[model samples]
Target: MSKVVLITGGSSGIGKSIGEFLTYKGYDVYGTSRTPERYTDSKFRLVALDVADTTSIKKAIQTVVEGSGRVDVLINNAGAGITGPIEEIPDVEIKRNFETNLFGPINVIKAVLPQMRLQNSGLIINITSIAGYMGLPYRGIYSASKGALELITEAFRMEIKDFNIRMTNLAPGDFATNIAAGRYHAPVTKGSPYETKYGSVLKNIDEDVDNGNDPALVANAVFKIINTPYPKIHYKVGAFLQKFSVVLKRILPDKTYEKMLMKHYKL
Candidate 1:
């Protein structure tokens, strides 16, 4: 029997690419989206899901397992981006961002764990971001949410490794996706202190995202991780400079790293 793969936010963007690619690779792919009608792909099955909602997450995973009998791989790729100055970002917006980017995956992981543990084999790939490691100026909330997921994934690995279940954090630097258009912008009031700075930083951020690597790169990475017996704990996809930025942040002094990031974002 083919391995069953479940991917959240699979209606579009990186999730869609991954779902389609995996289906072609012979996996029984099930993808989740808030609006199932929005996804017209015939290759993989689409299930209605709202990751931020625990009931929705539970129902979606239950549907997949009922249809497929097993979930060999679970990819938590559903996430939202919130951009703007930290202070300008509303509390509600921050909550919504974290709910999708961090807690959404958490709910899915919880829903799938029982079956995965009972089967004694599974792989969970959490799609994180390089920004998770370094704080971005205007996208601080997005970064924070991803960073939380990264840490949670690491901890989850330790907890579940004994169950023959594997976990990986796929930190994509940037991928060409609909994320920018759908991203939440924290309210920037007129004459606010962060208005001009936020605009400049956001513009630069948008350009970089527009020029990001294809989502197919991420799909290929996912394929490799699934096929490998002992995949690394972390996988990064993007251009050399973008991927290497994580390494730079690790090796450089705090002040130097901040300077480099500021220069890169033109802040």
Candidate 2:
């Protein structure tokens, strides 16, 4: 049977590329995007879904269930990026960020897990980022959400192993995608602490993303891992510099790691 895969945030960026690549590889790909206008593929089915909305999430699954007999893979890729100092960012924006990036996946996971448990098979791929593991300036809230997701994935990985349901976190450094275009770059709010200390943080993050890896590269990695016999819990896909962040985090001491981050970001 051709594998049935469901990818959230599949209209653009890494999600869309993964859907396209997997469809070409013969999997029946069903991807969900907030906007119906984001993707079009004869080989893959695109569903309208808003990860932050419970109704949208449930309805997306309903659509997928009705269209496809069964789902084999679920990719939680819908997330938002906001750049600014934590203190400067409004409380509401922080909540909104986590709502879309963290709870969004949790809801999808909750809805899909029962079916996957019953089937005793399924692959859940989270398109997390280096932010999940490292702290970056100007993206404090984004990092917090991804970090929380990493913890959640760790717990799920252990609990679901026996069920034959795999959850893998894909931490890519920077990928060339529509994400940059979608990012919310609030001004260095008038007379804020961050104005003098981190005015360039947003610009830096955006620039790096603009010059990063192609979305297709990440999609290829996702395809390979989904097919691996013994899939690992985390797959690091990014440039050499990005991959080094893992090593630095592990081998370097706390202060050293902090310094390295500052140097890398030119803080």
Candidate 3:
């Protein structure tokens, strides 16, 4: 029997790409979306799900299990983006970021863990971002949420490894996607202290995203991770510079790394 794979936020962007890719690769792929009707991709089945809601997550996973017998892989790819100065971002928006990017994945993992444990074999891949490790200039909350998720994935890996289960953090640097268009920009008025800086930085961030690498590359990375017998705990996908930045952050001094990031963003 083919391996059953479940992907969250599979309606569009990277999630959709991965779902389609895995489906074509012969895996029994099921994708979750807030409005399943909106996803017309015939390559994969769609399930109505809201990762932010525990009830929806549980129901969605249960549906997949009922239909497929088991989920061999669960890709926590559903996420949202927010950009703005850390201080000016509203509390609600920060909470929203964490809910979607961090808590959402956590809930999904929780719902699926029991089944994975029972089966004694499974793979959990969380779609984190390069910013998760190196904080972005204006996208502080996004970075923080992903960073938290990365940490969570690492901890979870330790706890679950004994069950013959595996977890990996797939950190993509940037990819051309609707994420930039959908990102929430913190409120910045004309007279606000951060208006000029925020505008400049936000513009630069958008440009980078617009010129980002193909989403298919990320899908390819996901494919490799699933097929590998023992995948690395963390995989960074994208340009050499972006992946190197993550490495440099670890080896370089704090202030030196800070300077490099600021230079990249023209801050």
In terms of lDDT, model 1 sits at 0.90
Model 1 segments beyond 4 Å from truth? Answer: none
Model 1 residue 20 lDDT? 92
Model 2: per-residue Cα lDDT over 1-267, one tens digit each: 888899998877888888889999999889887877644543478888888788988888878878876778998888888888776678888899999889999999988887788788998988788887877777878888988888899898888889899898888889888787887676776677667657666667778889988888888998898888667878888999788888889889999999978887677
Give the CA lDDT, 0 to 100, for residue 98 in model 1: 92
Runs of candidate 2 exceeding 4 Å displacement: 37-43
Candidate 3, residue 75: Cα displacement in angstroms equals: 0.3
lDDT, candidate 3, at 143: 93
Q: Against the true structure, whose lDDT is highest?
A: 3
Question: What TM-scores do the predictions have?
Answer: 0.97, 0.94, 0.98
> Which has the better lDDT: candidate 1, or candidate 2?
1
**Candidate 1 lDDT over residue span 66-184, tens digit each:** 99898999999999988988877889999999999998899899999999998999999999998898898988899899999999988999999999999999999877898999999
Q: How many angstroms is residue 141 displaced in model 3 relative to the true structure, after the best TM-score fit?
A: 0.5
Candidate 2 residue pairs in backbone clash: none
> What's model 3's lDDT at 246?
86
Query: Model 1 residue 52 lDDT?
Result: 77
- Per-residue lDDT tens digits for candidate 3, residues 124-213, read 999999999977888989999999999999899999999999999999988999998778988666888889988998888888899999
Report lDDT per candidate: 0.90, 0.84, 0.92
